[model samples]
Target: MGGQQSRQKHVALDDPESKYVIPQNTHKIKGLSRYMSAKADHDRIVATRGWDKHDENMQSMQMLKGLFKNLDPTVMKAVGDIRGDIQLSFKYDFKRQLLLIKVIRCRELPSKDWRSKMSDPYVMVRLLPDTNRQGEKKTRVVQQCNNPTYNEIFAFQLDELELMDMKLLVQVLDKDIISRDDVIGEVIIDMNTFKFKENPVHTAWYMLNKETDLSITGEIDITVAFQMPQSLFVTIHRATGLAARDEGNASDPFVKLTIPGTSVLYQTQVLKKTLNPEWEETFEFPIALEELEDRFIIFHVVDEDVSSSNDSLGQAIVDLKDFDPDRGMHGSYKLADLRNTERIRSKWFQRITAEEFSEALYAHSMSKQPSFIFQNQRTGKRVNCIVSS
Candidate 1:
């Protein structure tokens, strides 16, 4: 017999799903064997094409690697060199309850805009939560300089006991008038880490960081001083050029003297509705001689409020070094608003004279005596005798 004639079948290319509907069990061995062979051939072809395409891709990648390897090392280095963090310094005056932050300089600042080739940088400092709005402070912008030298000082009022809860935040930013300012980096300092008791004054350099990276942006130098004990005597004589805090009426002003480290506070009697008020009040404190170098006598002029908290008229901080124990300092000191340097009022402070101080001591001693008198035997005249042991 002649070889079995092969059967030819045709299926629509667009309607391939129609082939699956054919009775698969009825075809049995022959149909299943033919289907398996055809599937194997198709799979082999697909594998061969995929291999060839993969090889071509591998070759292309190797060529790209060789080209990149031939690039100049300096160009690669330039791409790797990015900007870093910044540094700051701080100084705390325990006696005045003042925290001073000094923006000394910033180094290795990356150029914010690649085309500009430089940055206009400034520093913004804030105590977190900036509740009073006055807690935020800033330094002047240095134009087009990557390494900027500010050497500017900003001050904050803080209690010595509350230093543990304080956190200082410093931000380095690139200034832009046309657009929003860009933040280069920032640092947060925990004031509690400092040992103020052991070393009353100390300086340290802190490395700045961005996120979790140890960036080499720059460093900051900080100095802190705790108040020591010292003897101080202050007299609030009078104030002039006082602004009226009350609406349409002159202020009822009084003077207050405070020692920040200690709970000692002294106040003068209030003077009613006067532009120029004379207090002539004297207050004294025994302080450590070593602490005198950092101590300041603060004079606060307040407008007495009957219904609410007293409003501050003005204030002045006098350095102890400015006063001489024997000669005493007597002059007019310009009064400024709290946390601000702009003068708002003028005030005169005069230390009591040696003769006056002696008289005061004598009077204080005599107040304890019930009855005492002295008679001059030679002149037959009576004189007052006050004695102290």
Candidate 2:
């Protein structure tokens, strides 16, 4: 190999023309250079801003804008071209006290991408004045389509008066993975206008209108357990996104639990100055297992005020029949607006008139001052209600 290379070197020197020969046409090996440049840039960034800052910047880039609300470019396009109609059907089950709503489909929906005439649409249904978010339901997203068919049914548990007063809000939104979902259109249906019983299956096509008011509130986590023959336990886990009721945009919050048709009120210790409070406090109630069937528990979130009575932040109602005797129930519930004590008392009175209970007396609304006491000599069941103003 040395002799051959020496001969070639001598020939090349003798020829002198080899020096003038054009170099072979070759592509540049740019991959390693590009990689080295990137590595240098990365190293400089890490050295200048530390690993923690570097990682934070990278994470921020991948974070989602949000799940819904707050209009963006794509959403704006859909909102402007809101020309569509939605089909819906309604049915009420008298025995279960549930109103079933079926989101049939959407037709002639406006395309988010005008060039391709494509859209991604879904339906969000809720009962108006839903304080606890228990009446909200949503459909799956249908992608790259102008018309989407979603024959989905959602059920809401409500009393007769509540059903009469409630309205159904149906919103058609365009699904966007990059940012908040765009609101294409919405429609509000008044329950009182429809005769759900006589017309049993009330199906109609509602014209999509402009977006309505969007009111949102905080949520609370709670768990309920049944301890056999006559004991009920409740735990207030935590609360998030609570509304500010005091100065400096904070609240000293506490929870009050009460069961109707019984003189039971349980409260948790107050926490100081926070929008999100975690109180893993539990309380118990003395009641028989059989009595839970037609009963409801009310959870009231209040802000403790040293100067005056505590201010109510919100309230929630849970039907005790939903609880499993063996396992009980646990959930993160949305808080609803607190109604007046008179309104709550009137509702309780309506229940008493409807149901056949032998010598039953109950007092509720822990925020109220007045309470009643009654005893039935025939049944020998004494009812006592003691509440604070």
Candidate 3:
């Protein structure tokens, strides 16, 4: 059995450790032993219900633990040990549902060259949880100056909910002529920490910290349908605001869909020289309904490179458990960085949604049961199924 393949042996029911042993009837027994069968049945049901409740409680606790995690001042700090300060102003229009951001200027930015003591500095701005809208802007480079005055204003058409959930990421960089632009520093402002009115603007200065993961900004539209018990259909509709990976401010974009931990990989045809691509192609996966709870569909948008490896522009993941087997699902999803997407399911809103959906499913299952009572013959124990009137 050490080297060669070995088959598992079956256990005999009468063996002491065998789990397949049948329960004693105890119908003729006159003592407490007569309650054995009924007690086992009751205990089994209670164990199942208790385990489910415990699982729900654990999920709730996890949600509570991270409810204010983003609002923490420590978490909103810059990423690294760099030196700089960027001033920004923000205001929200409640009636029009817009967020206005003004990039004021930067000071004390780190120099990016060995030859020159001064560096050309500029600011790139994007909204986090990059909603499939025009949320990116760039300020002009003040050449050979560590301190640059931008005074540029950018607006995002965000609803009240989006404004509340989104964060602003501003990256100061040294624009290069011969090489790729080098980042000077970054400032992340968590929107939850601010209270904005319709007219007044909020302004603040933030220290520029070192760089984090590559900027991920984009959104994709997809449609999902479950074809009963055996097939799952997914449609790659289109993508917008994809990050530019090529020199000409565009990317040869395509979508790759896969289920993690499985060998199933699918792709869409590449659209040349466009930040927005519409494929509207559909693919099918051989999946069963029972597997939905354990499956996640990842839509990875890639930039096709002829001479090099394909670049992952961004990715969006859909939890199969969120699908409605009856109507299915169709929506636009914001693309998240590959490095930051592993914890998407654990986000605060996702947790609340999962709990609500689970509760609704549990209620539906419970509603299908009939209210009735029965007596166990072996133990003369009465069982009741009561429903509230």
Candidate 4:
């Protein structure tokens, strides 16, 4: 346990339930979880939301337990005091087929290190593989040397990192050789890698495939959800790199999935780009519960119009049980990936997705209502509004 030693640990992903979802599914009432007893929030949600049946949903419940349990007791020293929560934000980089991590701090810090004399330390981050995408070859790691403050972050360039599983390991090494007794603050790995957040209006698509036939020979209409604070001129800026905005060459949008639940793979659409800022939006596409009359998915292929910064926009997955009412969506969620697309082994996901999905949604129900939890941007006051789903 050396203070400055580099220890590579397999980040055991605790599939804690999160309430955040896509498009309109994202809306919820804030502070709904607080009415329960300690560790009772998850159970409450399960009992009330039909999530108890799904083990994935249970994980969301377990995650809620872990979050409060993992919190620095000092932060919640007083009885009845609430704990710190995790937030998810996303930015689709069509050019790179990457989702940019955007987290705002309470106060801003300088971009470069030389400007201040604060005890800025080294924050190291690495991607941990999610079991679903475990079939792929190797994993990638990103080491950030001179990050500025607690607000400072370490990001993995998906293209360069090539981490198929997208699991992450984050840490802050007290590079301060002098302060061996470093009362160093924290190492935040926004588990929101799969769940990202953005203020500007954005779009995401969760699509479904036809369950009757397996051959993807016919044309597939991509199901898209456009979530925006306000509407404006929005179009695929080439379905490629956000860095290099081009419109002509891009992939056609297509949906893919796993029956009972589904996960969609957008063409170049995953790396969607837009020129406007100050817009907040989201989009979702649906997929078929069964393709070719079977319950499995390899990967969906959509033609594109241009090459991305890496020529591919990774992949997007969803819950099919949501589409088919009887599938019974459970679990918070447990995601896996592949270096390349293939027919998903039917056995792979049945184990954890239901529990993971259910628990995650229940846990998420508490935090999703930021309109009530966080203070107003201009006037520092907790907002209270009739935020309905």
TM-score list, all predictions: 0.34, 0.38, 0.39, 0.20
lDDT of 4 at 265: 25
Using TM-score, rank the candidates from best to worst: 3, 2, 1, 4
In order, the Cα lDDT scores of the candidates are 0.56, 0.66, 0.67, 0.31
- Residue 108, model 1: lDDT of 76
Provide the clash count, candidate 4.
Answer: 103
Q: Which regions of candidate 2 fall more than 4 Å away from where they truly are? A: 1-216, 338-343, 347-389
Return the top candidate by TM-score: 3
lDDT of 4 at 380: 45
Off by over 4 Å in 4: 1-90, 102-122, 129-155, 159-164, 173-175, 179-389
Q: Return the candidate ranking by lDDT, descending.
A: 3, 2, 1, 4
lDDT of 2: 0.66
Give the per-residue lDDT digits (tens) of candidate 4, residues 95-130: 665544433221111112244433343434344444
Q: Where's the lowest-lDDT run of ten residues in candidate 4?
A: 206-215
Task: Output the TM-score of candidate 1.
Answer: 0.34
Q: RMSD per prediction, one decimal?
A: 41.2, 34.3, 20.9, 23.1
**How would you encode candidate 1's per-residue C-alpha lDDT over 72-186 as one tens digit per residue?**
2221211112345455666678789887778888887778868878899999888753444556889999999988988888988877766778777787888999999987766
Please say which candidate is ahead in TM-score: 1 or 2: 2
